[model samples]
Target: MRDPFAPDFFETPVAPEPPAPVEPVQPVPSFPHRPARSMAAAMLAAGLVVGSVAGGAVGAVLVSHRNTGTSPNAVATVAPGVGAPAASPGSFAAIYQQAKNGVVTINASTSSGGPRSFSQAEGSGIVVDTQGDILTNAHVISGANQIRVTFSDGRTTTGQVKGVDQSADLAVVKVSVSADQLHPLPLGNSDSLQVGDTALAIGSPFGLQGSFTAGIISGLNRGTTAPNGRALTGMIQTDAPINPGNSGGALLDGRGQLIGVNDSIQSPVEGNVGVGFAIPVNRAASLLPSLEKGVAIQHPWLGISGQTLTASTADQLGLSEKSGVLVVQVVPGGPSAKAGLRADGQASANDDVITAIDGHSITTIEELTQYLDTKNVGDRVTLSVTRNGQHISIGVTLGNFQAQPSATP
Candidate 1:
C-alpha cells in the first residue's frame, strides 16, 4: 500500500545484496597456474547470489564475456539493482526485529497419539491483538485434533480455533500467551498497493523458521483460487518466494507494516517460481471484526452469474462503457431473479449489461468484488442496467452467500 504523504513505503526493509562477482585470473609470469577447469568453476561460482528466494533465479546464472587477454583482476559493472530495487537491508532488519515477536510458528497433531509421536505440521501466524488472538491459514490446522503454538520466544502452548472461514482460507486461532510473549503487528492499507512496490515476506518457509525474502509487487487485485476451493479476489501478487509452510505469514511493506497474508504460490515444481499471491490485509482486516466476535461472517451475494464485459458486447448492447459487468445468468428464485433482473437471452440477444452498482461503475469482477466486499449481508444495492434500448435501475437486497440453499435455486 502506498502512503499518500510519503513517496516511498516507510515500512519495507531492503534486501541483502548478492555476493560480489569474481574475476578469472590470467597467470602472472612467475605464479603457478591453477587448472583451467578449476578457474572456470571458481568464476562460475562467484557469479551466483545463492539466496533461497526464487527472485534470484536470473542472478544465479553465469554471465561471462569473451576472453580478450585483459588482466585477470578486471571487474565488470553490474546493474545497481536487479529487477527492481528493494528496501534497504538495515530497514528490513529493524522491521523484522520489531515484528518477529508477533509472529508464531504453529504445530498441530492428533489427540489420539501421545505427545512424542503426534502428527506434526508447521505454518506461520500473526498476532492481531493483545487478547492472544492469532490469524493463520485454515489449511494449517485443518483436521488437527490438537494445535500447539510456538511463539518467537520459543514458548509453547495449546491453541484453540476461535473462528474459521473455510471459504476465505483463514482461521483465527487463540493461544493464552500473555503480553510478554507478544508484539502485535501493524496492519497497513492493502487497497493502495501498486505494481512495482517493494514487498517483504517473513515466514517459516519450507520449515525454515523466520526466513525472510524481498521482492517487488508484481501485480495487485489478482483473482486467486484458494486451496479450500474458494475464489479469492483482490489478492496481492509478489515475486517473493512463498513456500508451503509460509502460509499465513506476514507480507510487509517498506516500513514493515503488514500489508498482506502470505497464502498461495504458483509453481510448476514444488519449489518457488517467483510468483506468489497473498490475501490483502485490507480484505482480511475487514472480515476479522466479525471473526473475533465469534460469529459466522456472511458476505453479501449479488445472485447473478456474470462474466467481464467485452468490447464487442458493449457495442452491441449500445453500452460502450468501460465499467460494467455482463450478466450471463440469474439464478431462479434467487435475489436477482426476485428483483426481476434479466440475464442474457434470445429476446435481448445478450445485449443488456450491468453498468453500475450503487452509483459505482464497475468494469471488471475485481471492482465488483470490492464493492460487494465492503457491504454486509441484508444491505440493499441498486444496479443500473441497460436493456434493449433503455436504461433502468433495480433494487436488490444482497443475500448471505452462506444462506443460499445448496439445492437448485
Candidate 2:
C-alpha cells in the first residue's frame, strides 16, 4: 500500500481530445489559474514530495495538507460571541463571509541543486493577526526555500518561517503586509467542541482557491502520528471533505470561529472519504508564544514503547495488574532508562506495568501520551508501576523529543 500521508507531485497534464456529441450541459464555474505544464513537469522531475510520512503506519495522510480570544502577545483573537450557546445554528454562508478574508494560499518551493531549479508545493494558511503571523502545517513549508503567501484579494507577498513544531505538525509563518490586507480570524475553544458539531473548512484544495466544504465533527481525542513520527493525541475528527492543498487551512465553527487546523485524512484512496482529522486550536495556541519568537518548541518525551496490559496477557505473564501499559522496550540513555525503569527482556514476568502517572490512572497508551503532552521537558513526573507483584513509584525527568527520520518512499 502507498504511504497515506505522502505529498503528491504535480503530474504533467495531457491534452484532451474533442468531445463526442451529446446534450448541452450547464456551464461550470471556472477555477483559479494553475501552474504551466512546463513548470509542473519540472517539479515532477525533481521528485520532491512534501509532507511525506516517515513511518510504515497506514490509514492516514497529510492533506496538502485557532481560537478567538486575544491570547496575550498572541496573533489570534477570540470571536466576539464564542463559548455562549447559540440561539440556533447560523448559516454556513454567514460563516464563510466572516472567514473568507482570513484564509490564504501558500506556495512553497525548495531548491533542487541546479541553478534556478526548484520544486514547488501549495497549501493553505489562516491569518492570526494584523502583524502578519499566519498559522499553517509544518509539512506545507518543510524544507522550503522560498515561501509566498497570497491573500483572498489576489495579492501575493513573501513569507518567512517564524517557528515550527514538527512533533505537532504545526508552524507559524510571517508576512510583511499592510494591516488592511490582513483579516485575523477569531479563535474558538476546541475543548468546547462536541461530536456532531457543525464544521466548515475553507482552503485551496487541488489549487482551487477559496474552496469551501461543510460537515460535522465525527469524533474527538483521536490519536495519530505526525510527519515527524511522533504521536499526536487529542485530535478532532470530522467528516469534512479535506483534501490535497487543504493542509494548514482553517476548520471553523458555525459562528465563524477558528476551532482546528486541517491536518490529515484516513482513507483507502489518496482522497477524502469523509474521515479527516484536525489539530485542536488550543494546542496551537499553547505554542503560539514560543512560535512567534522563532524558538524551537521541544515536546516532553518518555522513551519507551509498550502495549496495554490485558487480562489474558497479565494472567499468562503471572502479573497482578490487568489494566495498565506494559513496558516492552526502553531506549538506552533515555529518561526512563536513566531513571531505572525496567522493561520486559527474555523474561516477561519481570516486565513493569505502569498503572498511573502523577496519581492519575492510566489504562492505555493514549492516556499516557495525553498526560505527557501536558508536561514539559525537564519536569519530573512520578510513574506508579507494578513490577513482579510489587508496586513502586519511579521519578523520571522528561527529555526533549527527537524526530525520527521518515521511512516514506
Residue lDDT tens for model 1, 1-409: 1001111111222354522222322222211123321211000000001122111111111112212134232444567664544434446556677668767777655456666644445678887766677787765666677787877766789999877765576777877866557667766667788898778888765445566888879988776543333335777888876765577788887667788888766654435667777778766766665555566766567776665777776666566453467776676777878898887632234444678889998787557766887787889999888775478999989886642221111
Candidate 1 lDDT score at position 85: 42
Error of 2 at 133 (Å): 0.8
Encode model 2's per-residue lDDT on 323-397: one tens digit a residue.
Answer: 898887777788898999888643387888899999999998779988998898999999999988999999999
At residue 390, candidate 2 shows an lDDT of 93
User: What TM-score would candidate 2 get against the native?
Assistant: 0.76
Task: Point out where model 1 deviates above 4 Å.
Answer: 1-89, 109-121, 225-231, 268-271, 312-323, 343-352, 388-390, 403-409
Give the per-residue Cα lDDT of candidate 2 at 140.
80
- The C-alpha local distance difference test score for the whole of candidate 2 amounts to 0.70
